[model samples]
Every structure is written in structure tokens, then in C-alpha cells.
Target: MPIYKTIAHNSQTSVKIWKITESYEDLLKPLDLKPKNLTRVLGMKSELHQRGFLSIRHLLREFGYTDQDLFYDGNGKPHLKDGKHISITHSFTFSAVVVSEDFVGIDIEKQRDKIAVIAHKFVDYELDYLNKIAENYVNDLTKIWCVKESLYKMFATNGLSFKEHCLVIPFAKKEESTVAWIDYKDKKFRYNAQFLEFEGFTCAYTLPS
Candidate 1:
């Protein structure tokens, strides 16, 4: 297994990334996939998506887990059988998983200019501080998108609007940590969002303290 990166977040939380270099057949041969997942993986029309899905199982093995230990809820949020919080994401050539003792979420996105085109769909309150002409505009937008996605996975509440319910605090690229909030129903929630840029990919994960 090609484990690309690992973050030992405070001993209790872990983030593992896998670079998908193995062929689909090569990855499939080693997986301990349940029948449901096996069918699901084989049914995927995109080869990249199939590999990404398989690669997640590889990430699980890195954390001492197997497909049998994972389950998805009605909202399609994944949970570990041992009760540890879990979040998973994959993009293009990479797949990742974040496991933490507290409620957690994670996301990975390829930095692309197209994100700027769709910025208005998910960005609202933070636009006040964004610099559209800056060279980091795409990077900034991508980070914000990842933060909101991470929160969406964490909150796991249906009908939560990314534009209205999720808000990422402003921060420069040099800053590794920032705060995010989710306003839904009658309650508000806060998270310490952490992000990193690597290999042209931006990954963000959220944890509640």
C-alpha cells in the first residue's frame, strides 16, 4: 500500500492519505470488502472512483480497521463500529480518511480555477474578506470549500445550506488553523478547522474542541 501522508493529530486523531498508483485489479485483490461494498465498487462507472473507493479501504487498514468495521448512516456519513468519529474523502488520484475520538470531518480537493466559477454557490459571509484578484484566489476558494464540506460531513444534518449554514473564518494561507461555525435549526456549533496544501491538492479537516 502506498500511504502518501499521515498526520498523528494529538495521539487520538489520525489523518491518512493514500496516493492511488496501483491498478484497479491490484487494489481489488487485497481488499476485504463486504458483499455490499464489493457490488458498489464494481458498479462504479469511473475507474478513478473505483480506485479511490478501494484506496479508502487501504486507509482503513492503516488504522487497524477493515470494511466490516465501517457503516454508513441514512445521510451517507460513515461511522466506525468502535464509535470513533470518521470522515473520508477522495479526489482524482488521492483518497483520505480522518479518524478522531471527537466528532470530526475531512475533505480533499484538487486546486482548480473552476472552483472560482462556482464560488458563489457555497461562499457568502466570507466573501467580504476574499481578494478575487490575488494569486491565491483559487487556493482561498478551494480551502473555504473544503472547510464547509468538512463541516457538512461532521454536522451530517440534512438540508444544511453551505452558503447559509456554514461559515469559515478568514485566514491567510500561512495559517494552518482557523475557526468555522454551523448555524442550523435552533443551535450553533463551532469547530477548529485545520488545512494543508500538498501535491497540488488541498485537504481540510474539522474537530470540535
Candidate 2:
């Protein structure tokens, strides 16, 4: 299953997703590369991860860009020479990227019940909100996980515990939008997030205004 989806939010921003299920070699073919050559070039642990990386590079090509067009800042944030913001994420079998004229963040998480057990580790004030729900759903938990992950990616700093510093407003099951905030290093930043369901996985993207 090679799942690919692209969203053109506007002229200045777009997103691409690649869900990998085929052999690594087949996926590489679409990018004009040979397996032997890619193995040497990427040196990734698995062909799957290599293909995911290649997918990102291919996306850049779509925008008339290359790896040289990207670089990490001192804060470990990826930036484009053209000053566009980009976020990258990869799960067990999925990869996604978001590029925009302003700061953006994205996260993807495989749905699992274990997240509920660990919720206390990264969920605090939000617990009260989550408990208000009369019924529990795995999809609901996945949504919260994705939202927190998105916040972590956007903040990208150490010592900001999900339960302690990050908070999400209450939302109903199957809700598509929510407001979240993070207070890190004494600065608070808020964002509006949107969620999408993709093949038993939850993905959330946030844009800081």
C-alpha cells in the first residue's frame, strides 16, 4: 500500500504524505534511483526509512528545491534558504511533511491503547477535560497524543513535559479542530490544530499565529 496525499493549503503552503508498504526498491524507482546507489547514499537502517527520506526529497523537488535548499538552524529547526518553514514526521509506516511561509508543525501517531496509561506523564490540565467525556474512544486518545506531539515539535525544547507545560482545550469525539497552548521557558505560545485520520493513524498539524 503506497498511500500518497497532498494538500495545497494555499499558494504559500502545502503538505504531502507517503504511506509505505511496497518494497523499498519499487518506491525508489519513482525517485529515479537504484537500490544499490540509494543504500550507499542514505545508509539508513532499513529500506523503508530510506524510502521515507527519499519521499521528502522528492517533495522538495516538486517545489523546485533540493537537499541543499534545506539546513538546520542552531536550535535544530529545519529551515529553507527561501525562509519557508518545514516540518517532517515519520511513524512505523508513514511519513509526512508540511511546508509553509510561516512556522508550522506536524505529527503522526499510530493508534494504541498504551497511550492512555502514559497519559498522565504528558497530560495534566487536559485530564480534567478528557475525563468529562461520557465515553472513551481510542480515536480520542490518539487525537490527544497527536496534538501533544505537534506541540512538542513546535516548541522543540528540553524540559517541557507534556503533562506539565502543554495544555489542550476540551473537544468532543470526532472533533476536527482544537486549541492548544504550551508554556516553555516562561513563554507561552498558542496554536489552532486540525486532525486527520489516515489508515488507523492520527495526524495533526499546527500553525502558530
Best by TM-score: 1
208: Cα error in model 2, Å: 1.4
Q: Count the backbone clashes (under 3 Å) in each candidate.
A: 0, 1
Model 2 over residues 1-209: C-alpha lDDT tens digits? Answer: 43378877778778788776656666566664445545554677776667667766666666667766777776676778988889878777788888988778888888877777777677678767665344555677778778888777777777778777887888877678889888777888888887888788888888775
Best by lDDT: 1
- Cα displacement (angstroms), candidate 2, residue 22, comes to 3.9
The local distance difference test score of model 1 is 0.94
- Candidate 1 on 39-129: residue-level lDDT in tens? 9999999999999999999999999999999999999999999999999999999899999999999999999999999999999999999
The per-residue C-alpha lDDT of model 1 at residue 82 equals: 98
TM-score of each: 0.98, 0.83
Cα deviation of 118 in candidate 1 (Å)?
A: 0.8
